[model samples]
Target chain A: MENVRVIARMDIKGPNLVKGIHLEGLRVLGKPEDFARYYYENGADELFYQDVVASLYERNSLHDIVSRTAKDSFIPLTVGGGIRSIDDIREVLRAGADKVCINTAAIRNPEFIRDAANKFGSSTIVVAIEAIRQPDGKYMAFVDNGREHTGVEVISWARRVEELGAGEIVITSVDREGTGKGYDIALTRSIARAVGVPVIAHGGPGKKEHFTDVLLEGKADAIAVASMIHYDLIAQQQSDMENRSEGNVSFLKSGRSSFGEIAPAGLIAIKQYLKESNIPCRN
Target chain B: MSGKKIAIIDYKLGNLFSVRQACVYLGYDAVVTSEKDEVMKADFAILPGVGAFGDAMNNLEKLDLISPIKDYIRAGRPFMGVCLGLQLLFTESDEFGSHKGLNLIEGTVKKFPPKKTNDEVLKVPQIEWNNIWERADRRWESTPLGSCRSGDYMYFVHSFFVQPQSPDVVLSVTTYGETTYCSSVLQGNLFACQFHPEKSGHHGVGIYKNWLTNYSNNK
Candidate 1:
């Protein structure tokens, strides 16, 4: 088995970093660049920047953020959201992103994945599947940050993306996202087993044990974490970040930080716990 | 203070920013270009790419960079290739279909196996950070990878790997799933790796610095 990659996922809305439950009700965190540099220095294996409202705005404002983050952070950077055409992919790559993830565009026209993969190697293209569990226990894919339904099944979509030449897949469970209970193991394992490419499990990570569970039981090659690490960073310097002049800082000001009733742990501590459990991960 | 000219080859198939930024971070002025003259004049020329093998060859040929690159290497200038750039120097690749390469190195690029020997399904395009161990005589003290110790993890994102015909050229080997293949090679003034050193962090930068510090003035 390969070492599980722990990626710090930052959801961006305009210039401020935001977080929400089920990918809705956005709450401003802080400058993503600050959190990105912190994560890179602290031991984030990779950085994932997703423009949450890019599809709604019809433009991606992550190019500046991506370039600034890439300047100091030398790790792999992946940017997602609002990537609709080849030019959009090229612009992000030129802005210092190593990979571009397509969600809405990929769901709208599946062939776009093939074209993007063909133009920019499969390794450069990542198909992000936003999935929500249906009432009948079937996982259905969603688009636009889980704001719209695609009526596409998650497992079959994973297989199709891999077949279309996607080098990697990021299957984010909308229902589990931001809830911090744990990952949807069934969703992760199903997609992981459905595709030969590496699968990155996103959302629903609250504590250190949750990461262990997702990697061991979910069979995810990598895990994309947000609130868990984000809240931890904010908690460490709550005093310093209180006066920041960007985004809505009400969540930070409240000083009541918890991911689904459990306090979040720092990334370093999480990696230490993973190592003690015999799970391979880069320090 | 090395003052060595660095040219990152731009075949229009991959991101040249990270490679150039890595070079700039090392205090060397790097130029990303397709002009043959710029490439030939550079003290250190780098071929960095991330795309299919067939498309890369087409772009290189379209830009008329084939002869100059071959000449640059023939002149014994210090050269480095990353990811698809490393694969492009081989004889041919099995990606997409049969496609000829620069043939600068006697090798063929092949895809990773779909399944391991233990009947476990293997993931293509290993995208995780995996460690590399010294293979050829355990001699890394003089190569660009000298700064990195054995078992140092580097960022890898590719499905196909190169198989050099000459075993002596193999500098390092990495095992993914059940298969172990050549991860990097060093021959004369040329060094290439399947992993992206620019994205590999500080030790990776140390690689470019070592190559520049040691081989830059040798030419």
Candidate 2:
């Protein structure tokens, strides 16, 4: 049996790690590398960094951060957003990202997927499907972080991209983003079933059981965790270190659980829960 | 040739940096080169490749690397291959179309069975974390996977898998669908794995360490 990969999805805005409701209202968390290093060292099978403003600004600015993190981390790194051309993909890869995930550029130029896959190999390319449900009774692929509607149904788009040579498909739920209610299991299940490539389920996981459900019931090859782990863990670690030296203020102090349980700590907990539930995780 | 440098062969179709960085992470001095002399002369040569078999073989020919690589292997130096690099060691591959390989080992690569025996779908380009169990034997005890026992997960992404002629050369096997195919092989100084050990986290880096630690300069 294959083991499920656990990924940490971190949003980057300028130099700080940011969090927003459904990819909106950006708020800086900390340094991108700081969160990336913490996640990789803890048990993150892979890391997903999407620059929230990359497409808006028309430039992928996470190059330096990716290069620095690549030197320190050994796990697979994926960079997405604002990548408009094959040259942009090369630049990201040269910056030490193992794989490039594209959304807007891919929808704008579907042929770009085949071209990139042909040039860089399928494994280096990932098609990120930002899906949101509509009144027409179908999930449509959204671009620019759920800002633009491509009008392509999620399942059919997934199949089309796979045929076009996408090595993997990342299915993110716009409706579930940052809500922490649980995964959009129905959405994940459909796309996972539709595509031959591995599907990574992203957005909305507030509980430990969601990981098991999305993997087993939804049949996702990997699950990306964000809101739940990022702030809590970083704050907790910061509080511990701060309370140790100065006995006061910390960056993650408002996170409440600081000085108690760190972010990476949840990784071990969820991993253990998954194992106990008979789900094979990387040992 | 004299130094402890590890040469990573680049034929314009592989992730050379990540592999080199893995070795560098383990404190091994690694270099990426497509030059015939440098590759043949390195203390240890790591043939790391990605993409289709036909394209890779064609690129090797264009670079005039076919003979140099064969000559290097014949010299009995330690050589290890990753992914497509491993497949190119075979006599032939049926990916996209029939293609000729380096014929360093006796084998032909084939696509995975589209469906399992029980009617369950077997995904092509298996892009997931899979456990490569060691084939029961003593030969595997010497390869990079020596540290890994059965059921330890490693990352794998491929549409086709290599099938060797003789089971004697097979070092490890991974089950996909109802069939079990040869995943890793060890033929004296020649070693290769279907999965990317460089991206398999600690277990992956440990493989490089094991192979390097035991690799000698006798030749």
DockQ (CA atoms), all models: 0.75, 0.59
Q: How do the residues A81-110 of candidate 1 rate in per-residue lDDT, one tens digit apiece?
A: 899999999999989999999999998899
Most lDDT-accurate candidate: 1
- Clash-forming residue pairs, model 1: none
DockQ of structure 2: 0.59
lDDT of 2: 0.84
Candidate 2 lDDT, tens digit per residue, A1-283?
4568888899998888987777787767778898888877778888889998899879889999999988868788999978989889889988899899988888888999999999999989999999998987689999888988887898999999999999999999988887777789999999988877789999888778888889988989899988777766765677677768765654456655432222233676778888999998775
For each candidate, what TM-score against the reference? 0.95, 0.94
Error of 1 at A158 (Å): 1.4
Chain A TM-scores, one per candidate?
A: 0.94, 0.94
lDDT of candidates 1 onward, in order: 0.89, 0.84
C-alpha lDDT (0 to 100) for residue A152 of candidate 1: 95
Give the count of colliding residue pairs in each prediction: 0, 2
Q: Candidate 1 regions off by >4 Å?
A: A239-253, A257-260, B217-219
